[model samples]
Target: MIVTPPSAEEVTGHAASMYDRDTQDDGFVFAHTQVMAINPEAHEAFESLVKAIVASIGIGVYEAATLGAARAIGSAHCLLAHGRKALRAGVLDDDGLRAFAHHDDSGFSESEQAVVRFAERLSADAASMTDADSQALRDVGFTDRQIVDITLAAAARNFFSRALLALDVPVDVVPGVSPKTAAALTARVR
Candidate 1:
């Protein structure tokens, strides 16, 4: 069973305010934020980190990397969340976004394919990454800054996956997913 994190009402001070803002923004509090709310400072730091990362890479690339890593790790919650973000950013449609798990067969552009592969590789075994991997990204016209952003995006997704998985959070915790999208992810995970 999942360990229930403190609810918005259970928190006080900054955490409580953040929770209120999250509810206001989305009409429901996110489970990820709820988990982070246990330590308000950490939750704030996480939000700040996400902001810096998103600024470094455009939302499209960041969300793409996130989808790739989340898919590789089989985190259905992230897959749906980032998949939606990618769709909204016009990076891909739902079908195209879902195809990221096997991007080689998905008809994505060469650079997009490279980013997907990088995220998959990073999720699978980051320590095994070598100069050739970085070189491949450069070969695809990614600047060093963009490459770093991709790496950070993939790494951050893995960090979140590990934490959420360890906590036994249910995949349904993802908010605003359509039934079709949720079914697709559930089918994929199974």
Candidate 2:
């Protein structure tokens, strides 16, 4: 990483809490967690927003949107992390995740495919987005609130993934991810 994060012993308040939470959940501190802990308040706020988005749109859609944004942004980190999250949430099987990472929407429902396309467009070129982009989601029966939540999820992933990339944070070896799945997730990263 371009900047060294605080040591576990050196953190306090939210940083310490984040470290502890990562240890409890994943058995170690993630590189992204440690890096983000450098600004604990921002990290906490971002995480809270993500949680709210997931609660609003549901994990399956959140993961689909996240994966699409990650793939469009060439963020191996988000792809692997959220791909594992999708698996744990029962949103996708291993092969389905691999196919999704490769830009195949065949495994997804119509609504999910719309979400993915929307997220990819938003992440790749938000300035070019038109109202029709959102109308597509509406046509798929997504409420305005759900569309907003999906937008937030994709935008949040772009922010977090860009930060990690800028800082040169190494991708964590997500637990329970198969080797092939990991390879697929990172296939587009250079």
Candidate 3:
């Protein structure tokens, strides 16, 4: 069955308001995330599941791979959110975050460095993935199934990030960051 598009006011009036208010509370605007304005219920459900997976796995591994992919793909949206989240996950700090912004390698462990590189290559050219790529993950002790999960995690964010970019979402979520990213995060606060 097809669900009709929500009324414009239903999204703009109520959803937009709360989203913006939350941004203000965070001192960061993320309303430009169009998912905020799409189907709220659906978005929440999808996020909940993703969070559940992260909570279960322990964030260090999952987020490193995800953010690595974000950087490879140059996704401003994912990079901003994931940068903060990674810090909060205790996977890295402000300095670490800055290093990631430039693909600097000093802040990460050798294993982490490998994972990040794998994420970058995979994100840039999943279609070109070969036995060497699989071998790299295996060398890191990731089973085939875990590698699949890592790929999914990276790809999922790609979908969301591209969607937000397509919608011309303004991000103002983190001010110390780039302007477009900040506006995309904060532009359409509720």
Q: Best by lDDT, which number?
A: 2
What value does the lDDT take at residue 136 in candidate 1?
A: 89
Residue 107 miss distance in model 2 (angstroms): 2.5
Q: Over the stretch 77-102, how does candidate 1's per-residue lDDT look in tens digits?
A: 68877776676677777666555544
Per-candidate TM vs. native? 0.85, 0.95, 0.73
Decoy 3 TM-score against native: 0.73
Off by over 4 Å in 1: 101-109, 173-176
- RMSD (CA, Å), each prediction: 2.5, 1.2, 6.1
In model 3, which regions exceed 4 Å deviation? Answer: 1-29, 175-190
Query: How many clashing residue pairs appear in each of the predictions shown?
Result: 0, 0, 17
Q: After superposition, how far is residue 99 of candidate 1 from its true place, in Å?
A: 3.1
How would you encode candidate 3's per-residue C-alpha lDDT over 31-68 as one tens digit per residue? 44334556666566657657755653357767877788
Cα lDDT tens digits for candidate 2, 50-169: 989988788889988998899999998898888888888888899898888678876778899999999999999999999999999999999989999999999998999888998889
